[model samples]
Target: MSRVYLSLGSNINPKHNIREGIATLNLRFGQMQLSPIIESEPVGFIGDPFINLITTLETELPISELSSQLRLIEYDFGREDNAPKFSGRTLDIDIVLVDQLEGEHFGLTLPRKDLFEHGYMLYPLSLMEPELIPPGQEKTVQELWQQFPFPEQKLWLTEL
Candidate 1:
């Protein structure tokens, strides 16, 4: 088994989508420690703010299998297949990291490059694993959160 962190989001029926996403994830992968939800203005799309959350869990499935499962959850939750890039959606689930291990498979890499660059991922990540230090980075999640420059977007716990 490996400790994997996932990022989930929705701009459409966000609250409901988040709740359903959590339930689906738990049912498929067992227990999880969820971080708080964040309501942030759409990054590239102009629309309602998005509700984003992060969760860390242990899974026996391989990284590729886990990614596939998450993709299925998103599709099952009503995500569109041919939506405009970065446009608001019914759901988005990303495999943020898989422990400290980093390797390439099927032309994709674990610990997504944006994971260390975007506050969207780091903010919620800090809530669940404050002390986790990204590989090749000197800062912890909490430390990175402190240094990240994303504007003051609302972040809080939601009824789950």
Candidate 2:
């Protein structure tokens, strides 16, 4: 089984989308380790804050297949075909890590870079799995989250 970590976020009907996303993860992937919902100001496009959460699961599917499944789930959650780039969609699911797989050439190395760059991802992650260590990163989720400068924004404590 692959230890899969995914980040979920939405600005439209934030609460419902988050809950639905969790339900989808459980129904499609496997049992999920869901984090509390966090709210952060729009980073790229201009809009309302985003309700973000992290989910870790053990899946037998390959990483590529998992990614495709996640994309389909996004569509099921109301993602439009021609949605504006980063314009606060109904659901956004990003693969944060897939085991220790790495790449030397043009391919996806395990542990997505957003783990450190995006506080929204790291913050909730700290809450979910304190011992989570992204591939190639020495710091655990708790350590990284502590290092991150908590953005002075809103984050809701979502119940799963």
Candidate 3:
């Protein structure tokens, strides 16, 4: 089985949606190692704050199939079909890391670029797997977090 780390977030009806997303993922993927859900301001657009987290699960499916299932799960939770980037979402799930695979596989990029750029992605990732070094990156997630460039970007652990 391949170990995969997933990034999940929601802003629209955030509390309920985040819970539902986690439950659905648990049902679909079996038990998971979940990071604390965190609250953060929307990154690209003006909107209500979002709650986010990272989850790790073991899967027998290949990267492509796992990625497909995640998108379908988002759709089941009311994610808009053609939502603009930076728009509100009921659920947003991405494959942030998949084992040690690098570059693109089956049309998806491993170690998603967002992991390096977004606090929502990196912070929880650090919590879950501080020692994991994403493909082509020399530093661990904790190291990345320590040197995270955006001093102003912050994340708060939520009760949810």
Per-residue lDDT of model 3, residues 28-117, tens digit only: 889899987789998988898899999999999988788889999999988878899998999999998888989989998877999999
lDDT of 1 by residue, 1-160 (tens): 8888888888899888888888888898887998877777776667987888888889888777888888888889877778787798788998878888776754557677767766678888888789989776788989988887765544455544
Best by lDDT: 3
- For each candidate, the alpha-carbon lDDT, in order, equals 0.80, 0.79, 0.89
> What's the true lDDT of residue 31 in model 1?
79
Note each model's CA RMSD in angstroms. 1.9, 2.4, 1.0
Q: After superposition, how far is residue 132 of candidate 2 from its true place, in Å?
A: 2.2
Candidate 2 wrong stretches, greater than 4 Å: 104-109, 149-160
**How many clashes show up per model?**
0, 1, 0
* Greater-TM-score candidate between 1 and 3: 3
State, as a TM-score between 0 and 1, how close model 3 is to the true structure: 0.96
Residue 54, candidate 2: how far off, in angstroms?
A: 0.5
Error of 2 at 122 (Å): 0.1
Task: Estimate, for each residue in 22-64, the C-alpha lDDT of model 2 and write its tens digit.
Answer: 8878987667877877888877677988888888899888777
On the 0 to 100 scale, the lDDT of residue 18 in model 3 is 84
Sort every candidate by lDDT, greatest first: 3, 1, 2
